[model samples]
Target: MTYSTENTLLYVEDLSVSYGDKTVIKDINFVEKDVIRTGNVTGQVIAFVGRSGRGKSTLFRALTGLVKPSSGKVLIADTTTGIDNDAKVVNEGDIGFVDQKYTLFRNKTVSQALMFALRNKEITKEEKEVKIKEYLHQWGLEKVKDQYPNELSGGQRQRTAIIEQIFCSGHYMVLDEPFSGLDVGNIQDVKDAFNLMTASHEFNTIIYSTHDIELAVELADSIYVIGYPSIEGKLADYGTIVKHIDMKEIGLAWKDFGLDHMEVVKQIKAAMLSS
Candidate 1:
């Protein structure tokens, strides 16, 4: 598959996060551009994989503007400005974040929760209702539209959480350990949700972290391995990006999982173990 990049969709430069005296992530930098493919809408799925305590969560928090970076900036396409070259520093609520727990409003039904997510939209109530209904149907949550979070299954709740984010934020979304603690069936459900997002919008970018190397290789078009950097033959204390694998460049992205993908998985595992 051949594709070309247009305007920048996301840019992170010299991003570092610190908690008081401790620096968690340092000198992290990456950029993702709008992937243009003829006769197809191609969104980006970027994955971060590393050993535990490698600051993946901290990186995600900064990306979503939950936590401010001590140095550098995160920038995204400025859709609000309507200028193609305009970009904005990411702010809180600019990007939706869905943690592993799939948190939701306990008191709100699936339909009501979706309505709340659209509160800031300029659309009328009737329009919002129509949109919510459309999303519920499309996400396979129509049957549970009136049910509260407590009454829904894990997959249903996860879908609701994701849809809420899509309605609240714009194209950028950060999911921390989304596939963790999920069964095979539930994992498939999440993967389907990812497909739904990417298919719906060309600039819809999903940034996620996971320990599952094979799943990351299978789902992400670009993969970043975050780990301790080596200096003078010794590992540094601060975590940073050690290796970046572009599945698209390697002819592994958007393809069925096979020996090639397994090979990439092994490469990722080796990077993780050494760092």
Candidate 2:
């Protein structure tokens, strides 16, 4: 416990996933052990950086409880007790996930989807409308509010999905390849939303998956380099801690360290390619 002042928000110990005979992921041991300051750790975001088809999506599914892990432990650190509790204790309401696949009610409009996300709130009808309107404006979906998911462009649809998930999510906001399928404008919106949510204490764990190492380094406080699972004539490998580069510690306040960052990115890519 003395290792880090930051409270452990999540712990994945010896985690593995399988579909009958084929193992998708194995032995993912991850923990946040740094003694980060409270302000720096509360909204900490982590990225699982790896190539596609490397079980990033599968691991995300297991983390969100969509699929059960074949072996090992998945724990959520309790804030009060500082205990890493079992995964069984996690409920659907505990985490909000923005999936890689897109799904929408073909019959409903973007406005309807936003309202649906807030259906459980005890607020009045007037409050719901106001909240929906605010979100539409904030997410650049005001013009497409009445448009069905199919009618909207790729960027609009992605914005709608992200805004809905953010509104519905409680503690953790786990996004699978959020940067994918987004335009420059929409990507900026999603990035701003992540920063806002973390700063406002809307979500504790803002984790995502991406193959772009540069984007991962620019965003996440920590990175988990997921290794490609083994096949025929290949050595078995799972998720390993390739490197833990703290962005806050990467650059100094007195000097310009932009070039230093570029070097780190290159080093990370080298490690990934070698892995």
Predicted structure with the largest TM-score when compared to the true one: 1
Q: Which pairs, if any, clash in model 2?
A: none
Q: What ranges in model 1 sit over 4 Å off? A: none
- Candidate 1, residues 1-275, lDDT tens digits: the string is 78788889999999999999999999999999888778988899999999999999999999999999999999999987888958999999989999866689999999999999999999999999999989888889899999999899888888898989999999998999988877898899999999988888898999999989988999999999999999999999999999999988887888999999999999999999999
lDDT of 2 by residue, 1-275 (tens): 11133455677888889888888788788765323444343366788887556688888888777888888766665444535432233445556788888577788899999898888888998999999998788767888899998898877777777667766756677889988877787777777877766665522678898877767877776777776544574645555455566655544211333676678678778767755
With candidate 2 superimposed using the best TM-score fit, by how many Å does residue 76's alpha carbon deviate from the native? 2.7
At residue 231, candidate 1 shows an lDDT of 95
